[model samples]
Target: MSLVEAEIKPRKSLFVLKTAKTLFGELDALVADQPANSTAARAIVLAHMRETLVAARADAEAELLATSKGIRCAQNLCNAEDEIISAIHLFATKRVYPVDNPSEAETLAVSAVGGYGRGTLAPGSDIDLLFILPYKQTPWGEQVTEYILYMLWDLGQKVGHAVRSVDECLRMARSDMTVRTATLEARFLTGDKTLFDQMVMRFETEIMAKTGPEFIAAKMAERDERHKMMGNTRYVVEPNIKDGKGGLRDLNTLYWIGKYFYQLKTSQQLVGKGVLSAREYRQFQRAEEFLWAVRCNLHFLTGRAEEKLTFDLQPEMAERLGYAKRVGMLGVERFMKRYFLVAKDVGDLTRIFCTSLEFNHAKDMDLVGRVFAPFRRGKVKIKGDADFVIDSGRLNIAKPDVFTKNPVNLIKMFLVAGREELLFHPDAIKQITRSLRLIDSKLRNDPKANNYFLSILTAPQSVERMLRQMNESGVLGKFVPEFGKIVALMQFNMYHHYTVDEHLIRAVGVMAEIANGGLRKELPLTHELLPQAQ
Candidate 1:
């Protein structure tokens, strides 16, 4: 019953799922008391976890019906619930099922569909799971189905348990192992009885006879597709989805999309590594458990179909997570349209996100810091030929065409991806403060000395301009009141050849670059700090 549970990372944003209403207290107990050296132990633990998630999903449906935000999240909560019940049965039943050396059919991964597939869950919640039945491999007369059933009953504890015969949950039943493996998307919640039924009834028999060990191998294909869809956006076009100003809709979309995919991959990774076993119940259960906090909000907004959703969104910090699609184009597209109005600019993200005004002047400085954040933090680097850059007003910028296919905002994309210094540091505010302090000291000794252009601009002045740009560009809305008045102070000044206010404006722009890791590549101020930067 946590207020909100989400996976928030510098690159990933927020991922909050609503799949943990079922296993609330049960999963916590099992993790602490995990039994030793028993296959059934995996199954037992997973079952309780799955239950917690499903129960929570039921609550979310009730709330989603109440608000506009609820409508978006609730759109899929039902499908998620259906998938939850199906997966619970599949995973929990395995705990007591006495199938000898079941070859561990990756239960936890499949069941993870209950939670990760749907949303982020509460901590201590079990992961959801799903299992592809090996029905066609052996004849009905060759194995003891009774033993498997008995084991499931004994270990399941009547909580969250379910299993979809491979033949029942999919479409175009693929038993070549390779095909079957690549088809499962942890982000989507589904129990395709159509395909699952076929797999159990006939597909496995056809493929097993001629399948090669390598043919059935699906380990790498999943990553490749995910990389294409969730990580890279070389050719993705911006989706025309507009959020109509100030709702922070784009941020929310980004978080969900990234969380949606990470939950899928991470769950599979956990199962493959033996940290989790899918044949047991907690598979989908755990996934749901992880989503409790996220759903607490969705349930309130969506209106639960089953239970009461009594959580608030703001104080809990639920929607701010910004997780959705690994922060890739899929998520970024939504964020752009939701917050900004695209315009032509030489900025990193301008093609799809920004206004003619923001692009022409300060260049949506606040957003530039956020978009290039991954490169700034050293989490990743966006590479391009040096020839792709051009200079605008003494500032080195990226070629407009080069960013045509990228989701990274255009204006600052160059410094963010180039051989720039680290700006994505989470402590950007502190560093900016320290750097400005250094410039302030230097100015005291000799006014004619080199001015640290990046450090001099304080908030309210330069920062205020960027905030106004976000609203004008249709990017993000302005909320922090303290930040509002700060934007109000200066009319003009003398030390700056440009208006004193103009000087502060430039200072803020430079500060943003330094914070975003673009200062060194674009500014001469970092000449002394370069060696220690990269």
Candidate 2:
């Protein structure tokens, strides 16, 4: 079974519902003795539930620390919160504001949205809820929502909520991409199932139908803007596990796309839909599990919803995750290396997913191609190579065995891409990755292969992008074994902001920018002497 499919044996200590029920029963007895609706009675209930929440969270954290099962901990915590909210809903309706015969407008359906709707809760993560009503707001509906919100707030939960009728939800989702995305993940938690089901039907027929392209474009743009804001790289020493490139947000983006376009309920469904192979799905699961584990550790260590893997928390996070000191690497260093490698895997999976979207015509080809397209100065002649073909202005292998037939094609592929100013088709990249074992010592030492590598490195056109692609695709590392060792190596120090391989690649990119006059104004001296050295 895949990691995601493995059942998590529930730990009784982490189950908050049992503890919550006992406390609620005690609070009910106390409230019965007090005057109805008295401030003192309300205080008694709030205090008891507050204590329940605190103890439940503490117990869950303790269990997580002991078992190191972060994914299960997240699910358990979410389940606990579900029980608490359900209990609140019952108390508000049955005890506080009893309605013998309710009108349709009085009905309310509570649904979890966003990350909460996805059935995971990191420590300190926001609890997002959507309250759906059958029609315009009734006094009872308002009262119920206000009561639930205030109760959750009093218990020290960070709750984000919206109360909307079904029509309002459809209208708002039509105008707002964020609302639409959240609604896509909406999972009914408690309340009128009929109302929630109606909203889902309308959302599918009225909003989601024939709008896959628009939603995909907006999401891709949003992701690009976020990546630009988050330093535009996944290799930063201190990375944001939630929003950084190749972080949880990237994984979430893939899931969002799959869900929006294909109506996939879970990422595993993507495999059955042929968007991802079984192996790729395994990669997805492993990366998701590791990233969540790290994010959970960060939240526990800081006692808040901390997302960044900062240096100060690195040691404790390493120790908590069971990383140990090795011959030359600290536990923290080892931990970070694993983090970067996982991040890279995320990037690869993203490329594969996006390419699948492109093939399905769900994603814009121009936008995807522009990401890896180098600056085009002038038209260049195309070299005749039967094994290669240009498709949609991107380089692609003519056959699957192009690389296996001749391992040197791995190095030559980059050369052709650099020379032609084209991006490798995602399938070609996938093929190259699968054929890395073909890059033996003989192929590495071959003069023709070395010459192709040298040509790519010294090319007058920007070599930075091609070299980076080679590194990411595993060609540079396998062909040049020295670079392989440092692929994700982290230097334990404050001065370095990136892993050794990333830092070196960035340095080369900077020099290329200076040589190409892209940064001449910023570094005139270096630009002036760049040619003199040549």
Candidate 3:
């Protein structure tokens, strides 16, 4: 049975754990007996992993049957295996780091990105670490990152899995495996969350500011190297080439293609399915709005769009993108075991370049499946009023798992994270403050208005959030049906009930119907769809 075989996977880990130890011993003996470089090491670790997983499958099944517990049994076994196996790997990984030499970064923060960063590690998953790069902003960032990778390489020589650097993590992050496996499961193993968080901050401030320009340059830089290594503003991520296709990336053309096409593709797909109610479709429209806010790309050089690549593709395309059918989840281990394997990695990456690279045709290409799968899964509950809250702009949030490794998450916790520290940048908040004043300038003279404003001071992301809850429960619709005809589904919330995104759908109707003629235009909450109901 496969390691993922439900009956066997959970219980089988102890046997695998023992085998991993045995293999490490053999590798250690080999290394001790000869020069580390001269020792034949590749077969040693691979053999161990294969043996461990296979034996684990057999053993786990027997144990599960012997100690039959349903429901949480599988989950419990998986956790048990996770405990021992991770312990073993962690011990092995540390030994490779050496007690003798330590890194010199003024601040060293270790973060678990993707799954491990989020405190969820599977039985035999490789641990990911993003070294808080103290030197990234200075000239030292490059050197520091390089040195960190070298250390990881040396460590990898000694152990089955090596610690990956930020670059490696980000590169792999884009890989099919990272998406299916690590994105949801990552958690930090060491270092202060603050330091790791700072690294993200520096990366964003220094990097994303010029993302539009530097991204293009980074792509060009990679083209010289078979388009294997791609860069964003902060770090270089690897793009593995595919079979028979070598050097496939063309940044200039591809960037624009990704920017224009993904949103267009996703929008079209929503319509094509037409499964969602019109109200729900409008909610999806908000997602489309954010897609425009944050751009993602995987543009090719030149090729016609494929039928499989269409946003409206049937269920079969998942397999073409190297996934199971819709019901079949593409988990992280499956990705690492199947596609992110070195040969396939190189082959797939290169295929894009040789594709007579096509622009805006990647709908068939993203191995990650739907970009908003996490949001859709309700894995990360958006705290405030946003139907889907993203970590962008002045405001940000961190899912317990990913906050450490991601730059945006890191920064928010480090610099501006404090309740006291939430002060907006003087220059930046000026315009926003002025707008607030314009909207409520009369509040200064009205004590009641001032009191009411004070009441909602702590609830920045809540106004619309409550409205969303109401909308989801269909409460907004029930409370005010008369305005529904004019506003469709738009509704408002209490404080920001009729305005903003969350409640506006329900509130739009009221604003139009309640206010007579020109008077409707005066209130900031005046929208045809989501107007104030109460």
Candidate 4:
């Protein structure tokens, strides 16, 4: 009973149906006298299909211009792609299989998997497809799949496809996590629904049930590795919005985790269970919608599926997104800033979602959980009359107004974390985050709090790590308001290798290394002058 239950199927869409029918009638009239399976007949059908696809794309773009809702436009594009693929499947099946009556209960299943399967087609993105057989792959299935792929290629679509039996699919899903993840979002486009259903049933009952934790671990590791690969930072001059640390993939990861863990149909279901509040869900929707709009505009601008928001396109995209130059900032700067803000929202949502999963599903420390525990838990110590107590390496904040009551405690908690080389538990982090605003002008200039912050920053152990944790927890920005402006701030020139915030953090890390004599060989001059520098 979720709001989003079905794929954005073009066959079910009246606009697509009307468009396809009109084009098909023209194709039929042109090939009326030719043999059904003749080369000329096939060419006619292909041409008509291509023409219909082009027209549909134009309509979708027009819709985007009219409404500015990229989701709707993406769905429209998916629907058009579906209609084209479905038509091709039917056309080729008759020639190859020669069934007088084609019933979905009897043969192969043509499914759209991955991004395509999710029914959000970015312009010029690859059409990932699957041809599912009830049993083993046969000659007929092979021929049909080949014909469809070739025709799609002829129409200039970049296609990635696989032909697999139900058994092969299950085996692949079990063996390869990427394959499994892609298969999880597979949607039926044209062919045997029964076959697709059988695959879905077996995947859910047999594959998905036992593999949730394993899959989660693998996916989290994969995300960590990806973040490392993508500079281990969310802010970049030119970021890949689809795969960067806090990009669309992060958002998609949360949804995937929810779907696997809860067997939920739609993300809307997560709201009902308090996994995300109504406000958070609205933020989620806005971030997704904005990212999609930017992505769609990028595709249209570059005439391909261009995900990276390069410097050159920033101004154009900003203007297109209705942003104009302000007094000091250019249109492009404002646009990039907005993009980073969306990415930050994505980061916030990711933290909220992963925290929910940790409390709800992580009953015991699995291997992957242990690997990522640093991102969630902290050192255990119960001392003083603190409102919160640490039990079993987890910080439990017993009082909600702990920080509000004593603002200096903000720097104290981070000091304790830094001195002990412990991470801030999510609960502790959450409390601190909620009370960040309390560190106002007076508190920032507070002698005691400032001394505590400086001591933590200069701490011998894990100084850089603590600083980053402080920044991520929003403490650094609150303490030094000017620092907030440079966060995720990209320098347009090539001389600066990292974003402003990243460069600053790296500077601190390098200083920490030099202070500890860890960079003696790299900086002998600094090492010799270490005492004077100190």
Which one wins on lDDT? 2
Residue by residue across 477-502, what tens digits does model 3's lDDT show?
Answer: 33334423222211111232111222
Q: So what's the TM-score on candidate 4? A: 0.89
- Candidate 2 per-residue lDDT, tens place, 1-534, comes to 112543467646644455435545676787886763567877877887777677767877877887777777787777778878877777677667778998887899999999988888888899999999877657999888988899999888999999899999999999999999889888898879999999999998898876777787788889999999999999999999999999998988888888878887667899999878888888888888888789887887899999998888999999999999999999999999999999999999999888767755523434444432333322233568777887655688887888878888889989988987777676787788889899999998899999998898887475888888998988888888899999888887899999999999888888767766787678888877878898
- Listed in order, each prediction's TM-score against the native is 0.26, 0.93, 0.25, 0.89
| Residue-by-residue lDDT tens digits, candidate 4, 237-328 | 78888899778888788878778877988888889877887777888888888787788878888898888888778778877777787888
**Please, what is the whole-model Cα lDDT of each candidate in the order they appear?**
0.32, 0.82, 0.31, 0.76
Better of 1 and 4 by lDDT: 4
| Root mean square deviation (Cα) for candidate 1 | 19.2
What's the lDDT for candidate 2?
A: 0.82
Candidate 1: deviation at residue 55, Å? 10
**Worst 10-residue lDDT window, candidate 2:** 371-380
Where does candidate 1 stray beyond 4 Å?
1-110, 118-131, 135-295, 298-534
* Model 1 agreement with the true structure over 1-534: per-residue lDDT tens digits: 111232222432122343433432343355455542255565654465455444545444433323323323433443444344443343343333324454434222233343333454322223344444543443321222333334334543222323445544444434334234323323323323434444434533554333322221232233234434432211112211112111112222222222222222333343443322353113223222222323345334443321211212222222432524434333332322222122111111211122211223232333333322122111232355342322221222233333233222322322332224222221221122123323223233332221221222233223434433432222221222233332212221222222122234456666656655565756766755755785
Q: Which ranges of candidate 3 are over 4 A from the true structure? A: 1-32, 53-99, 103-110, 121-186, 190-534
Clashes of 2: 0
